[model samples]
Target: MANNKSAKKRILTNERNRLQNRFYKSSVRTLTKMFLNSLEIYKTTRTPENKEKVQNTLNSAYSLIDKATKKNVFHKNTAARKKSKLAAQFKTA
Candidate 1:
């Protein structure tokens, strides 16, 4: 238990932030998975449709990661690393 009022408020704020961070983390994971799946499909099918889909997925994932980084949910360097890895995957495929 928090002995002080400010400490109690801090605990409440921390809990809220934790929940919000969890949501962002989950969303990021889902978006990354979607992008990876698109890349895999593109690799196997090699169709123009798949290419476009993969590109769109990659762009969306990148955008979301940037947002997360801006919100402090993710570190800037971590976001950059993820974006770079995604771009490399697209390039290789």
Candidate 2:
């Protein structure tokens, strides 16, 4: 428990930051899933429209992952790994 005023304030601030981080993290995951699903659809069709959708998915996924890394929610290496995997999936799709 926080006894001092400053400590109580710190606890509140931490809670707020935690919620914000959680939101960002969940959003990232959701975007990533959307990208993956788009890629899967692109795999079967291979039309220009599907390709454009795949590209957009890749771009959005990259942006969110990079943002998460920048905010320190994910490690730089972890982000790199994820980006690489996404790229590989895109290529094969």
Clashes of 2: 0
lDDT of 1 by residue, 62-82 (tens): 888888898899999999999
Which candidate number has the best lDDT?
1
Number of the top-ranking candidate, with TM-score as the measure = 1
What overall lDDT goes with each candidate model? Answer: 0.90, 0.87
**Each candidate: RMSD:** 1.0, 1.2
lDDT of 2 by residue, 1-93 (tens): 989999999999899889878977898788889988888888878899988988997898899889988888889999999899988887776
Residue 90: error of model 1 in Å?
Answer: 0.5
| Off by more than 4 A, model 2 | none
